[model samples]
Target chain A: EADIYQTPRYLVIGTGKKITLECSQTMGHDKMYWYQQDPGMELHLIHYSYGVNSTEKGDLSSESTVSRIRTEHFPLTLESARPSHTSQYLCASSPPGGANYGYTFGSGTRLTVV
Target chain B: AQTVTQSQPEMSVQEAETVTLSCTYDTSENNYYLFWYKQPPSRQMILVIRQEAYKQQNATENRFSVNFQKAAKSFSLKISDSQLGDTAMYFCAFMPLNNNDMRFGAGTRLTVKP
Candidate 1:
């Protein structure tokens, strides 16, 4: 099983509410990524972090923001949630190199803006 | 920019049989990584296998294997001895060595019938 963990497996909240999805990993990987995926749809890269204090926006336009204060934690926050932001948020982490292992993914957080 | 494509949106295979999922990607970099991720009904993105762009040999992980054709810009996943546990949505992804963004395909939903 993957070492990455995502909290609040599912969430349903009113529009315009502030929500944060938590992702943590124990593998001590330097790279972490957050992706948004709709049901049976493509995954859009929203945010990613290479190391502590380093965060970058992905190819997809997103209203959410992320922080990487620690090596194991990368959390995503949405200032004002909307129906369009409702989707499954996945977190993944991978080692720098050497091992050449594939990415380890979290269980994912399913958010619903109701 | 890199783009991954999975032409088949849905596929089905009988138990104990074999199934192949096709994936193609576009990238300008010569050195990069390709990956196949599986998302079951639970919504978790699980890494099935990975292949390095520079490697001519394909990658295999137990029952899951990939056909990597660099010249054709094609990477396909073949699952031998399909099982019910294999029923899930599979996504193909690409990551260039110069960056950390792992572009993913729309995914192919596979169902294994008993």
Candidate 2:
């Protein structure tokens, strides 16, 4: 089935450690997004990409960084993890047109900083 | 910027019953799209339904449907014949037409009891 995927479905990392959350979509969608969500909370937009080599920061002002070097892969990186960084990171992609069509979301990466 | 709101923090429904989750959004833009996403215990974020701002007709997908009230800026999700699998965190989202910026509301935990 066509879908978006995120690896390391659950992670427990120590503070000051570096980590990367992997996201890849087989749908060949041009637009991709990264969202951060705490348990049972609202999702905050952290980063987004239009296409290859194009990335932009979202409204949430995340300390993490992201890169879109390939059309199917958009990975988020945290240089130094902190307790505040413990949250679920979700990856999604949409059609070229826009949000009129629903988004395809991945199984998300749940990071727990200890 | 657009903001979405989900008033109910938690809800419960018995199997085969109908349940409605409320959602409201604030936007100056005339055209946009609304969506309901369900995050299961597996942490997979899936789209339950979507409503276009310009379309007067509500959207439906199997047991899932949406009540779209454009004038009131309200889009609510209605799940009929709820099952144990329907238990999840429901999120309301808003996105401007042809734009990639999607905003999510604080989620509401929905429990479907057998």
Candidate 3:
């Protein structure tokens, strides 16, 4: 089974409330990524981390922020959630470069800012 | 910038039949990776198959296989003996060798009907 995990499989909060989506992996991967997806739409990269203390914005601009203080943990936080932030957030991790590289994705958090 | 395209928004196949989902990508890098992921109603992304750009042979995993045409920049997934459990939204992804970001297509929803 995939080792990546995301907490609060679903969340519903009012606008302006602070929320955090938690992601953790036990596979010891160096690369971790966060993606946002709407129902039946394409996934957009939001944030990614190379390792501890290293995080970068992805192709899509996001109001949320992420931190990677540990290799196994990468968390995304929205200081003040809004209805626009309602979507599914996926977390993934991958091993270093190689011919057979692939990613293990978490179950994802479905957030709904009411 | 690399981009993946899945023209088929949805497709259906009878159980035990075969179905193919089309995917195309644009990239300037010679060395890169392609992937197919499945997301069921549970919202968990599952890795279905992967293909390396340098490999001439198509990648296959049991009933799952890929038709990778490097010159055409096309990578399509063929699912043989489709089962009802195979119903899900499938996404095509691209990852360049230099960067860890994975670009995903709009995705195709596949329904294996009984």
Predicted structure with the largest lDDT when compared to the true one: 3
Query: Can you write out model 2's per-residue Cα lDDT over B7-41, one digit (the tens) per residue?
Result: 99999999999999999999999988888988878
Off by over 4 Å in 1: A98-100
Model 2 misplaced regions, further than 4 Å: none
The regions of model 3 sitting more than 4 angstroms off are: A98-100
TM-score per model over all chains: 0.94, 0.95, 0.96
Docking class of 2: medium
Q: What DockQ score does model 3 reach against the true complex?
A: 0.65
DockQ for all models: 0.61, 0.75, 0.65
Task: Residues B10-113, candidate 1: write the lDDT tens digits.
Answer: 99999999999999999888998898988888966777898988889999999999999998999999999999999999999888876666788999999999
lDDT of 2 by residue, A1-114 (tens): 438889989999999999999999998899999999886568988899999999999988999999999999999999999999989899999878755677899998999999
| Rank ordering of all candidates by lDDT, starting from the highest | 3, 2, 1
Tell me the RMSD of model 2 versus the true structure: 1.3
Best by DockQ, which number? 2
Best by TM-score: 3
Chain A TM-score for candidate 3 is: 0.95
Clashing pairs in 3: none
